[model samples]
Target: MRYVTTAGVIALALGLSACGAGGNDSAAANGSPFGDCIITGEAGSSPLNLISDGVVTVKADLPSPGWYNGDTVESIKSGFDYCLLANIAHRGGAKGLNLQNSSFDGLVAGKAGSFDMALNQITITPERESVMDFSDPYYESTAGVLVKKGSTLTQSDLADSHLGVKQGTVGQMLVDKTIKPAKAPAVFPGDAEQQAAVAAGRIDAGIQDLSIVLGASVQSGGKLTVVGQIPTHESYGVMMPKGSANVVAVNKMLKEMKDDGTLDKLNSTYLTEAYGVDPTTIPVWSF
Candidate 1:
């Protein structure tokens, strides 16, 4: 499977910044006031601090088992917080907020005044953005096909086979829309479960995030190979209540991270390491 290296990611970040600055300031300025401060549900001890009204509060929202186990969540959170602090230092103050980790349904229902922003691995879709505001994406990845080593399938050889994917994820959507396989099966298992099924010959192939699939493949001693990639162009972003002031603050921080190479570094540390891939070779996704 192809991989990305740190140097390559740094170049991509520079290229993105040169092409366009992220965040829509006009949208943020036209939105709601920044008054309330809270982080409803997050993992571990409160690693966030609010700087407003001459008060600083630290709160914790513990993550569920599934959330805490993934490298993507941790990496994104680190980059988010790092950018946030820089923004606060340069911009005077920000509304403190954190997202609660609940089921997808719980998140969609809203968490009252718990947090002003949520940083889960939320994929941006027109249907979702219609109800909630989404910051510029923090991470971009494509779907990939995982098969046993030495499989005959090439990157384009799986259009007619039975493909497996976790139900309700970008992976599933990519398989449905991009691959349009002849016999796609809905495999609603966890990442580990789906990977295990592929390894055990229960399925011809499994569709998953490139990061997760590559990470698991390395952990299994190269027993699997990613034979195909789906060009669905998925991304993860910060979900905020529509018209929140915090949007500006978050975007500011994100841009700074991009400028200083912090974003690329974080991706290298967590994602590239997990997948045993060099950060420089990660494909660039056009914004």
Candidate 2:
């Protein structure tokens, strides 16, 4: 089963400490907060939609990229996306759900107007918890290093190699806190940019989430390989308004989804079995 880690337990304690500050503004004076749950993600892209009649319907012109297959809504609605959707539908308390395009800054800070919940692979950290509430982790991931095939780069070389990491990501944090490369890390705009830089030989290695780097290795067609994985505690949670009563309800649904094997099926179909990467077989590198 998916149990919260030690770090997550501390986070929950800290979150409880702030209870004196009061619950989310959306909360009802009587108790629970239930209404039209507004789901949001970065603008210029459709990150969520309602599935109807076996077809995923999008509110925008483009569709959310849920998996490696395509940007089509149907193609993208597996894994975490499906887990979140299935839980919400199974819970059945909210008046309705609506999708809105928003800014990352706004969503991370829980100030994205009109949005009750936010998703999009956002990581939960203590700093962010001071301002927002996070649901139980839907995805657990670790840092992974991607390198050119047959490049013979060892774990020891990682500390001195020219590493590439995306700005404002956990990969960059891992590099700073654990890898400590001799030279400065080559910062890129995002995962795509960092992967491209590694592919072009602009950097010695690319550091990112295991799923991302593993997918890169598969798509590279024998050009790239995941050299190692960092043993770190990291998970993605649904961000919600701070002190929102919905947090409890959402967590319950997430746990139910996990217990019933729904989450395992989705992960197997979209990530583990489909990607052909044995997470256990991936070599572990410590900090």
Q: What would the per-residue lDDT of candidate 1 be over residues 237-282, giving only the tens digit for each residue?
A: 6666666556665665566556666565555543443445553354
Lowest-lDDT window of 10 residues in candidate 2? 10-19
lDDT of 2 by residue, 163-265 (tens): 9986656788789877888999998755666777888888999987676677677767888888888866878787777766567766766676678766655
Q: Which candidate wins on TM-score?
A: 2
Could you estimate the TM-score for every candidate? Answer: 0.61, 0.70
TM-score attained by model 1: 0.61
